[model samples]
Target: MNKAKNVTISVYSILLFSIALYTLATLIYSLIPNIPVNKLFAMIVAFTILYLYIQRITLERIIILLFCLFFSIYTTIISEYSSDNINDLLWIVTTVLIIGIASDQKFRSGLEQAIKRNKKWMKMIIIVIELILLMAVITPSSYGNDVGWGKDASYFVGFATHSHTLASACCLLIVLIMTVYKDKKISLMEYAYYILPIYSILFSGARTFLISVLILIMINVYMKKNSKLMRNMTLLVILSSFIFALFNSSMISKFEFTSNNVYAKNMLDSITNGRSEFWKYDLDLFFNSNFFIQLFGRGFEYIYNYNYLKVGIKIWAHNDIINNLISIGLIGTLGYVYIWFKYINNFFKRPRIDFSKVQFIIFMLFTLYIVAPMLLNGLYQYQHYIFSSVLLGQLISQRD
Candidate 1:
């Protein structure tokens, strides 16, 4: 029985490590811009899931996975079935299966125990992520030119398709590091690890993530009293440096503070960065459509088929809520919202250790990072979903 348990734990460890590797590779592809890293990683993940399924078939896991698969198939059949739509459908199915596996009681327990036993490997993963981000920061590329820091320098995308994704990943990384740090006093090197990711988010020039990180830092300061001085000083330095960088870069020119009205107008414009226009167009399209279209949505290919804005941009709704409504209709949007609420409720209800107070706060902050821009952006990519699932699994794991 002990040997069997060891094997189970080893299998789970390998699964999680593979997921992390996939995420890292995806980030690297973003920086290099030539590799089909995500596709290759997706194939590996699919096979891993198949292996897990064949090794341990359970009624509950199958039911949940099938529920997600049903939606994927339904949406694909309803849409134009273009490569993009099919890829999206596949990603959704994969995400669901991964979440289902991570959430399984036995699997999650074994995974957590395996992780605890393999702290060095986990640390190596973090180191790899940090090194990749460092490489992205140093490497020059044309990415993020559209909404990134003006022509002066490209906003940091850091192995992500966009700045926002990088910011979101950074936010998630910070939360994970902080969760670990909360258990014990971390060295200055570890503190640097936390700072690097936060700095990367700032460098990305993603307003939503920057704002979320600020709020998180403030809350951390208030909640943690043991190392108050050092924490505040570090935060102060980070904020000061970020402000200095913004003023030195082209970002300052985008803001107008000549007067209160100008300041307000510019602030709104800067924050929204024309996203309000996208939202307005999406809302108009949704409202002006026929009953069936509005209720059931025009499918995922709606934006590609119908250009309500006439902007010629191939992308559809920029906002997650609006995108869901436009792509999946009202029915799907409600279900989407319910899933998030249920996840949050379940997370809070789970029994946790004393350290969970800090963990909960970090989780909420991460959720805000996920939820805030999602109001203006679409669903997070596959890597983000995997990272989120891992965090959720850790949170839901039985107390050690």
Candidate 2:
């Protein structure tokens, strides 16, 4: 039993280590962009997670492996086995493992045990992440120079590859911190830590994060079932946010990046940052496809090629509903619908709110996710994958 427990903890540590390494690599990449940090980290974490997963495989695990294999073969065959097939396979495998690890009851339990077993190591990892988040705002980075919003719309990406990446990371960090510290009353000094991610999101210039966070705040406040500390902190955020908005209208107005675009007067284009165009284009393609293709999806390779051929840009639909319709089809999109149904079902079945519970965090994260992916290619992004795993894990591990 002890041996098995230790193995579980070890696997959990590997996941945590991967996240830490990824963040550290991002920071290092800002200084030395040519380093093979990404390659090394991917190879190391991939091998470790795959080995651990196979060693403890069950019938259910075999079924999942077989499904992934089948999907890979189908997509590869359909797409003529392009190089992108390899990347798609890796992404699917990593996503499976992330969600699998999170959903394991023994693994989740071992997280607490591991914290007690080696507090220093866990604290070190947390401290490293905290420092990185702080650096994202205080020092900032030069890499997030995006002209998509507008030529003059410069963003503060910090150590992340893009402004959106930094914004997503900040959102994830906020949820994780709140979930971890849910049971305790955070001191005023400790509560100040929330400002780091909040400010980081603003400077990153991702309105998706801004709007999503606002919705989360509204839901939490309306429920009004959180801890005293959480309530107080939420109130503090509201007060400070008002003050900041009042004094820093110029900074807040930076989100209006579509002011100079041809669609400047178009409400839909302005609000969606022009994603509605991509969404409509992809939806048209999906509708024009044969019934079978519409049911099962056109596959990622097909969508990639089709988008490039149509617009000379290899990109997604920027909307998960449309992305899923084209890539995974209506059948796969229904899986997402089921997830929503389950969350809403659970929400209404309860007499009171989960409040600052991990479930609450998961609910809020999912809420934000539903909004972000509509305008950004967020469904398949690594940061969202990590948080999706946490959300899935919480949903699966908990009982009605």
Candidate 3:
């Protein structure tokens, strides 16, 4: 039994390491411009690692697998055999399978232990890579989105595919730091390391990422130091004030705020950053669809094509709920919500009054890093989802 447990730990550690390697390869590919095989090679490797463990199944795993199988067949029957559809189908299969494996109690237990054993180096390596990526900000991407709408490439994409990607990656890295450190006090220098990722998110021009990370930090600190209520509250208040001032500062003000860009003509547009328009479109499609489409929904490729045709540009509903409604339909969305309910229930079933526990910390991190971003930015297909699935699994594995 001990040998089996050790073997489980070792295998999980290898899987985590494989994911880290894939992420590193992605970062390198971003830096080196035209790599021969490209980032897909790394993604394929990571997926292959997870795919090999598919035989480790449970009732939940079977349901998730069936969900994927149903959608694949439904898509094939209804949609054309286009590359976009095929790629979307593959992505759905991969994501659900990852979540399925993560939902397994045994797998989650092994992975949680693996993360605990290796988190120190994991935190250090991720922060170092984050710093490296930040330095690359000076060398702008050839096609970085111009927040000014035509003025210049002011958004700091750094070495990422987009500004949002860099910001999102930084948020995930911060989660790693929180998970490893837990409620432990650290030196001033270690605290300063937190600023590096925060700064990266600020410059990346992802408004949602910035807000979410700040909230995450405050919540994390508050939970850990809640015993000293007054002191921690004071600290969080001061931190919030500083962040508010930083946004209003002259330096940050120079770059046009994403919401204040030329595209936003009115108050509602500015507040939503034009996402309301996309959401409205998606909602209309959902409401107007026939029974079959409403029940199973059109696939993501269909949404992409629909958006392109209607708007003359490719745009997704930035919100996941709406995105899922139109892309996967009511039944599929309900299935997804069911999975979320199960995982969420698992996390909260045995809440520790001492929120500093690693399981609780991981739950918070997953909520902030994965759930929030996916809901706000339609990041269901984000690269970080791979790693976040492990976090989700870890959260679900907790029994007490």
Candidate 4:
């Protein structure tokens, strides 16, 4: 019985790891266009099978799942179905369910142990992802020419939907690698590995990610021992300067301020870009709506409809918090905020001495990743939510 149970656990571990890698890889592989449909179907099937085989149906899990289901159904009923809204709704439901499963104490422990036990494999996976991004940078054929919302250039999209997505993925991967090897002494080669994703972020021209990485590096320098921290910081500065020189034109263009007003220009030069106008419009719409719409949102379709008709631009709210308030309403937004607060609070309550330098770095980066986007970019991307779910699972499992 013991042997059989061990074998089952091992199989589930492999399945879970494969799903995570596949989800990440699809960011690049999705450039093929037709492959995403099949890939997504396969991922859903695998996840369902894994959940059924490994997870025990408990009251808590059931309640959480039901809550997700209810929200999904509510969203569907309140709004007319469009492909984008349907996709967003599906992603939310899937993410909530995964988080629910991951919150299971036993499953979280098992998953964390499995990851630790297979560090070598995890390292290989990270390296592979880095290589994919590198390849995307070197070969123009790997990325599409359509500039979704970012500037048009030979920017590296890697396997992501856009340059920003690629930058976000690289940033997240850097934090994950740091978390995985937080205690171990990293060698020169490993440092080079870290540079790969940093360069990818630079080449992708993601200012938000660049700012976030710089903040993270500064935090590391402050938190670590004097000599070693200075050495690492100096190395990072040198590497960053080299990359910036290589992509001077792109960097300059991104930083160029078009506004004449000093404060507006400064704000635009920062991560806000043109998002302030969008946010203002969204806020106006939300406020002017009826009581029901204000309380429970006007749905995803409402945003596009309002924008196209009034603002002359067919775009969703670029801010996540605003978007959530506009789409899911006050109830859903409050619930989401409550869960986020609980997770962050729980994480800090853990003993400070128990965390390594890298772990602390991960915590800071994750916090920035979650918070930064709420002000500028919407977190409608399923892959990002899925990644967050896994990270939260690992963090929660650390509780004794």
Q: Best to worst by TM-score, what's the order?
A: 3, 4, 2, 1
Q: How many backbone clashes does every candidate have?
A: 1, 0, 0, 3
Q: What TM-score does structure 2 among the candidates reach?
A: 0.77
Which of the two candidates, 1 or 3, achieves a greater lDDT against the reference?
3
Given candidate 2, what's the lDDT at residue 170? 62
lDDT of 1 by residue, 225-310 (tens): 45657766766876786677656642343332112222123445445665565566778888998887777676676765554435
lDDT of 2 by residue, 1-400 (tens): 9897677777656655565455556544555677857546656666666676687788756765665566666666676666555665565456555444444455556545543455456446556777876665566345345546555545677776776666666655554444444334434544465666666666666666676555444433433446767776776878677457634632354556654445334677666665666567788998999999888776666767777776566766666677768866786566544544444345434555445464565465555655455446545445443553353334323422
Best lDDT among the predictions, by candidate number: 3
lDDT of each: 0.61, 0.58, 0.62, 0.60
Model 3 Cα lDDT, one tens digit per residue, 12-75 = 7777665565455544556677772324643563455455456465565667878877988887
- Under the 3 Å rule for N, CA and C atoms, how many clashes does model 2 have? 0
- Best by TM-score, which number? 3
1-400: candidate 4 lDDT, tens digit per residue: 9986676568556644665465466556665776674256436634664464345766766766666667778788888879767766765555555544544456666666666777787787787777776776677664554653334545566766777766656655765665455444434554576777777666665666666556544433333334676657665875577566646635444555323323243465344665676677788877888888777786666777776675566777776678778887877677666555565555555554477665566566556656675566665453543454365437433522
How far residue 299's Cα lies from its native spot in candidate 4, in Å, is 2.4
Error of 4 at 16 (Å): 4.3
